[model samples]
Target: MRRNHLIALATLGSAALLLGAWGFQYLGYAPCKMCLWQRWPHGAAVLFGVAAMAAPVAILTLAGALAAATTGAIGVYHTGVERGWWEGPSSCSSGDITGMSTDDLFNQIMAAPLVRCDEVAWQLLGLSMASWNALISFALVAIWLAAYRKSAP
Candidate 1:
């Protein structure tokens, strides 16, 4: 495909993923902090895609690639958090509460978010949504790179 088409495809791919994430949210999957963080880069990429189409600047394509990579990295981090490979944000992750007073513990429980970043609410074939995002976003990165290379003089 031509550079513009490739850029459009990559942008559309991000839009589709974002829509899917929102769909899942609408279906009652409340996104945690990390999940929400993963969406921003996709949004930026979509904007970058528009700029790329309007101007076809190499820099915009590069920015799109970076945006994709940012989301992909966040996805990987979220996957690790979900799998307990590492800790997530304290506000979103369930941590030890043993030292807290009874009232404090109760308050913490009551104030806790409905969604926990450390838990996988949905998955397919042992891969969580974050994992899928990472995989797909990386593919989009490749598309962005291809567009960039194609536009290179």
Candidate 2:
């Protein structure tokens, strides 16, 4: 395939993922802090894909791959957090309230993030959205890399 077509396909993959996220949000599935974090790289990848299409630069293609990898990593981390493999950031992870003073507890509650990252809001066939994102983003990374390789001499 031509470099432009490859770039377009990679770009469309990110665009489709973004649209799916929005569709889930519209369906009342609120994204947690980590969920939101995973999205930024996909957004960057989509932009990079566009730029790569325009310039056909190897650097831009690699940048898109990097962005895809970033999101994939984040999604993996989120999956770990959701599965209790490790504690997520304090902002998004639930904590022990047992030893806290009443005031401290109240303050923690007030300052807690609107959505907890450790919980899976939705799942399919036992895989959460984050899991799906990781799988798809990794695929995007491969496609971006293929485009880069094909673009090279």
Candidate 3:
């Protein structure tokens, strides 16, 4: 495919993912801290995609590729946390509070976010949303890379 088509596809990929995240939010599926963290890169990629549409520059494609890869990595990390393979941040996941006082524990509980990063609130075909995001973002990464190569003169 031509460079412009590739760039548009990559940009649309990020936009679609962003829209999907918002759609879930609108449906009352609130995202956790980690989930929200994964969004920034996609948002950036969408912006990069728009810029690439105008300039179709190699730098823009490279930047978009980086953004896609960033979100993809976050999605993988989030998936691991959700699967209990590793612990997530204390702000969004339950952590060891063995030495905390009773009041401290209570305060922590009270201050806990409505959405926990470790919980799989929704899934499809045994894959959580994070898993799907990672997979799609990987594809987007490939598309962006192709665009980058094509944009090269």
The candidate that wins on lDDT is: 1
> Which tens-of-lDDT digit does each residue in 51-75 have in candidate 1?
9999979999999999999999999
Q: Return whichever of 1 and 3 wins on lDDT.
A: 1
The local distance difference test score of each candidate is: 0.96, 0.91, 0.95
Error of 2 at 2 (Å): 2.9
Over 4 Å off in model 2, which ranges?
none
Compute the lDDT of residue 92 as modeled in candidate 3: 91
RMSD of each: 1.2, 1.2, 0.9
Candidate 2 least-lDDT 10 residues: 90-99
TM-score against truth, every candidate = 0.94, 0.94, 0.97
Output the better candidate (1/3) by TM-score: 3
56-115 per-residue lDDT for model 3 (tens digits): 579999999999999999999999999999999998998889899999999999999989
Relative to the unseen true structure, what is the Cα RMSD of model 1?
1.2
Candidate 1, which segments miss by more than 4 Å at Cα? Answer: none
* Model 3 alpha-carbon drift over 4 Å, by segment: none
Candidate 2 has an lDDT of: 0.91
- Highest TM-score among the candidates is held by which one? 3
